[model samples]
Target: MAKPCGVCAGVRRAVETIERALVVYGPPVYARHEIIHDRHAVDELQARGAVFVDDLSAVPDGAVVVFGAHGVAEEAEHDCERRGHDVIDATCPLVLKLHKEARRLADRGYDVVVVGRAGDDEVDAIASRIPGRVHVVSHLADVERLEVADPARVAYLLQTTLGGLDTVDIVAALKHRFPRLATQDGDACSAVHDRERAALKLARRVDAVFVVGSGSAVTTRRLLEIVAASGVPTRLVENAGAIEHGNIDGLTAVGLAAGPSTPDKLVDAVVARLKMLRPVEIDVLDGVEEFVRFRLPSRLRHAGERSSPGLGGAPLAPGAALSHDR
Candidate 1:
């Protein structure tokens, strides 16, 4: 078992916000992107009346539009507003913090360096905020080729889901070349740091490791990379069905980890499947404990109040409306 691995607070908040909106507004709530990266989560919400779209234009006029957990480009928000659609911001607060930092760094005359994959939604959003001043770099080589206005006045912001070691190495390269580069005080979010720590520990003891999450989940990929780097064999599977018996035939110990967007039920199913395959000892490693909870947006909160009676009589408490079994 892997510790500090499962649905994260941000993903939970985003999903619950959409679910509440579905209960209150009825069918056809439009989401700008996948509410979170996980396909199962998106499909569950789609069944509950959430329509995920890649562009705002796909949504009908006057409909309620939701921003995804990864955040959206500024122009996307502007387009929604210009079209007079009701908007609900479901962006994770941590991502929002990075957006603010990017804007501040650019406004303060610093050439901003964003460390992340080029086409990732969150990376695109941050880079779009301050186009001319911000440059995205996924590797140290990208940093080396950067042509900034002033090397001495550069600030770096990492993608919230990057592995700790990757971020450190890239930052070190940037600092080495520019000497005066400014960076965030920490690596990714506390949850990411905690998961990496637990994965490293588990890798040291386990014969093999499994990461359960969608292929697109950056955090899950990061965890897999971290564990694999420790010289332990690791595989990423989306669910129990994806796990093959042949992979773990003779293994007595296996480590399991999940991304922020991975549902708890999916993780449980994987565990149950592994047990059925053969006799094995499951031990959840110890890691950081998270207590963060983001508040629902005002519109969603009001909608919840208006629709609470039909959803079991009391006020809808965040994710209370979601059907875990689904």
Candidate 2:
């Protein structure tokens, strides 16, 4: 099983923020993206009257708005200000930290290279913030083709949710080319490394592996890549309902791995389906839960009237986009 199986700290923070906003702001709180990758989680919140929209234009004048774990770009931040929506920024602290590092280097006249996937929302958002020439490396080969204004004035930033040997190798290439490459400390996601290792270990002892998560989420794709690379059959399922008997027909042992954005109920339901499919012993490997905690925006954190009236009701001042953190 995905040893450290639960929502990752960042995703957990986003989920909690939306939940709290719904409680405080009443029905129809708006989120610009799916926020939580798991459809089940979104569906549950939707049933509770949370409205998910594609753009700020869809959000009404008085509704509270949330930015998902995949941080928003500066352009969108400007839109929020114009719309005068009370905003709760749920961008993962790790992402915010990386964004800060990118801007710090860029502001100092350095060309920044971001190690991340193309078309990934978070990567796209990160790239949007850098005002200079920015390069995004999706593969190790991309490093060879990278050209910066000055190798000495170059720094690198990692996609907050990405971590693997490839990133290490690419960063190594950058260092080899630029003697003084400014790399970020603690940019790698330990959650990704831990979950991938757990899934690979489970793959060794199982006939097949089922990764519970949305394929759209980057973490789930990484798990499938690692598991499939191990030569074990792997299937990405959204929940227990996606499981088919044919997929596990002849399997005696099945490994379960969950993406960081996956919810607990999704994993639990998968485990239950596997057990119900046959009379087999189930083993959940020992796991230590994630220790990190990202504080929510003061508005969402005090959804219980602790500063409730001041936080949710008032539209952010013309220039204010995100609420101040506690």
Clashes of each: 0, 0
Residue range 1-326, candidate 1, lDDT tens digits: 76787777667767777888887778888987677677876777788789988778988988988787788888888888888998888887888878877888888889999998888888988888874588899987897899899878999898877767777788888889999989654434666667788778888888888988888877788777778888889999887888778988888888887767677767777888887888767677777755555667776666543321111112345664422210
Q: For residues 1-326, could you state the per-residue lDDT of candidate 2 as single tens digits?
A: 65886567677777778888888778788998787776777888899888888777888875688888888888887888888988888888778877777778888889899998887778888888888889999888888898889888988887867756447788888889888988776635677777887888888889988888888876788878888999998888877877767878888888888867787777778778877777767688876555565556776555431311211122223443323242
Segments in model 1 whose C-alpha atoms lie over 4 Å from true places: 185-188, 243-248, 275-281, 302-326
Which is the leading candidate under TM-score?
A: 1
Sliding window of 10 residues with minimal summed lDDT for model 1: 305-314
Error of 2 at 239 (Å): 2.1
lDDT measured at residue 36 in model 1 versus the true structure, 0 to 100: 69
Against the true structure, candidate 2 has what lDDT? 0.77
**Alpha carbon deviation, residue 260, candidate 2 (Å):** 0.8
lDDT of each: 0.77, 0.77
